[model samples]
Target chain A: MTDTTQAAPASTRDRLLDTAAELFYRDGIGVGVEVLCRAAGVSKRSMYQLFGSKDEVVAASLERRLPASEAFLLPPADDDRPPRARILHVFERLEVMTAEADFRGCPFVAAAVEVKSPEHPASLVARRAKNALTAFFQGEAERGGARDAALLARQLTVVFDGCGARAVVQAQPLDGLAVVTAAALLDGAGMRS
Target chain B: MTDTTQAAPASTRDRLLDTAAELFYRDGIGVGVEVLCRAAGVSKRSMYQLFGSKDEVVAASLERRLPASEAFLLPPADDDRPPRARILHVFERLEVMTAEADFRGCPFVAAAVEVKSPEHPASLVARRAKNALTAFFQGEAERGGARDAALLARQLTVVFDGCGARAVVQAQPLDGLAVVTAAALLDGAGMRS
Candidate 1:
């Protein structure tokens, strides 16, 4: 027999995370704890025993996803491209993600919209991620010599949000990328040669 | 008491619509039918008898809010300003909306994210409304002699979507409007005087 049977506890945690991600992504965070437990094939007791509450599960899922996104959004220290090129690279990465068959918009933005209460742990985590993005954009814009770095950073963030929503809503990934690139160029981030 | 009793049916429908909108906007469309019925003070049989399904209630609620948005998006002819001015006017109106106390992103965009299937009737209606906005944008861009009207229209739509999401998520309406205006300028649409 294969060794798959031996790792039940880890597998259960993975399953719970995967199920929570799907439900939170597709149905929003308001989905009940019992529903998540049933979908994950774990008992409600196991879920609470492992993660305490739905909010903790959400936080764990976000913590798992955020690092991957940060890796994609932040330009590498050794990267030699100009600030403008780095900005375009971020949008290019977005395009590739949205092109996937199961793309469902930015998970962070979705969480933010669903959690109305700012005091919620999930909301606080999401806000931290969002603020980090804004700061990253602002730093990049400053390096790019934008006269109004704050304004430009804010505009770029808007483009990021807009592109994600447009890709999902229009069901066209390339169209959203085209808009992102056009917006970047318009904002004076000249296209790479 | 004599006339009040006769106005019950219309009032009930209005109450249901209002309650559904609140729940749908806050909790999402996946909220159970029973929860909606209980929240609205209507019996399950009455909910089904009147609206057919939860989907129909969502559709009707969206339709109820559509006219206000449509009117803002497609304002009556104003010979006083050029087409570009009129186009930018739409964003200004949206800015006012975001500034409202109860502003919670664009309901259509939020609903679209919740409803996974693109072919759902409510999704279709939201899509049609979005398409109409794009077409309206294209007409204005064409009138301004843009080289690529379709592209500009798509770009503008993304800006609107992004700004609305940011406004709701950040609870900063002015920030959203600022991004919108910046996007308009970047798209080569001259600032309204």
Candidate 2:
């Protein structure tokens, strides 16, 4: 095998991306580019040369968070459960997340609140992420046989948003209460027994 | 009555409070004190004399928001209803708030997330505000005749948190959707028909 210890050119990009994600996710994109460059052990010129602008770097950082959110929202394939069960799994994941040390709430929601301009690319991505999750809930509600899937989806989306806020703001794990409550609603809707 | 146009000696204090609230609420507290002083038509020395530091000014500005929140959370005496109805009324008020032209997400939540330190007095106030809300839901759930009142209260709290985030982040109005959804949950818990 080649000596992997040598500094790699691509490693710089990775370092920059990782540092940007942490700072943006923790503080917000309003943090200056110079701070990010220093934290990443790169010069401003090199950072600009690689990422073009601060916005692009923030976009890249936000893109890193999507996969984790996707995993949180989706159910495990081996579970083999009804749509309601699958939907509830998302909350279970969130509960676990809230229990993690240094949990500061949903990064996407936090970022969405901080990024002022709706037209900003980072804001657009955050919005799309929320929309995608809402759409997924809508699909799940429909499959679960709600009379008004759209309404149910919207409601579930509200619960999801509330759970994240409670988890962070209250500094308490949401305790899977949102899922249990949502499941009860679905069952009452005649979607489940 | 005294001349209405005659400004009181303490009017400067009120002006600083008003300007800080407007700026801090519209933009985050990061906006410089000079800007706030200019907007309020007060001198920097006067601002310093009135509020010693920026943090003190920010705390005072946030304190001003508390009354509005209290009004929203606790409505007029003639508005008396059952616990479930009262809970729904809170969301109804929030719907109006979300539709306002300058609506932002919860100032407390925004401030809490930015401050990072849980020990900060402002952060403590933010936490207390959230806890107060949760306690309100719990009290309502218990009064509504739910067997598992605490569980139901926590669930409803999540719904409130979610609605607030969605209103600001997704630009969605918290209307009949949250009300209907939450009412359905309370109904399922046998709190309502």
Candidate 3:
């Protein structure tokens, strides 16, 4: 057995962001800054030195989440599925996420709801996440030859957002209800059911 | 004359709940009890005397919302309208709520997301709100003669929940996106298009 196989622990700043992500997403931003610092095993001075303010930390936590979220909506690189089929696949991914023990609905939505200012840095990030998803839907709808790309995009976005909301509010795990609804909506749009 | 004609002020307990409902819905439940008491103009001791705890205040706040929320989903008591049109009318009610200057997303959904515990009194209210909506959908689906009323209830719930989430998160006032989707879904289920 190797005696010195361990890698270095996460850096102080990384540790703080990781902890902040979990706390803010799990418990909302009402958690006091002091409580967060202590939970992260970080000194207040170090946290300030690294992130400037608690609001910035909230923004940074969501920023760190961007990559995984983008991946969730992005169709697989290797699959050659039709655009509409690929779009519907996002729900399957949502089901897997909802089934996780840590499923807390959409962090961006939670962040936006907790903040008062639309101008808040975190609110901007949250808004951007949703807007980007609508763009994804529009692009997919266009690829699928929809009669009205914008309409399809908004409908898809509503259903996707609804699934997250219903999942968390009802405190039920994912159930593919949104997927079924989306398929029916697509059929009515003249796409193959 | 004005002084003598003035009605008695609201009870301190009612004041506290009124304030709590406004604050908890406008902001998340992350608002401190001190802030709530200040806004309510009730001393902390008096607030505790009435509601016993902040969590109970939150629970009571959602409970206060029940009648209004139910009215939004309920069909007209004496009207003989078709089931699907009646169901889609809920979105029209939602649009009115969304247009209110003080409108936030569903209060129960907001409450559920902020608190960590599913067992939290507020979370129970949220789950109950969602369950009640699902039942409304199932009843409507059955009346509409859908082959699978339960499935329609769940799918409709998903779309309805999505609309609220999308509204608050995107900071857009409610539009008819959910209604249009619901109409198409109903048509697919054998309701007239």
Computed on C-alphas against the true complex, the DockQ of each candidate is: 0.49, 0.56, 0.60
TM-score against truth, every candidate: 0.85, 0.87, 0.89
- Candidate 1 global lDDT: 0.73
DockQ, prediction 1: 0.49
TM match of model 3 to true structure:
0.89
Q: Judge the docking of candidate 3 as incorrect, acceptable, medium or high.
A: medium
Top-lDDT structure, candidate number: 3
What are the per-residue Cα lDDT tens digits for candidate 3 across A92-119?
A: 7777777777778888887877775567
- Top-TM-score structure, candidate number: 3
Please identify which of the two predictions, 1 or 3, would achieve the higher lDDT against the true structure: 3
Tens digits of per-residue lDDT for model 2, B1-193: 3654456646888888888878877777667888999999999998888777887887777777787787876556686787878888877777777777777677777766655445656667777787777788788888889878888777877777777778777765665666777787788888982
Ranking by lDDT: 3, 2, 1
Clashing pairs in model 1?
A: none
Pick the winner on DockQ between candidates 2 and 3: 3
Superposed model 2: Cα runs more than 4 Å off? A1-11, A50-52, A77-79, B1-10, B43-53
Model 3 ranges with Cα > 4 A deviation: A1-11, B1-10
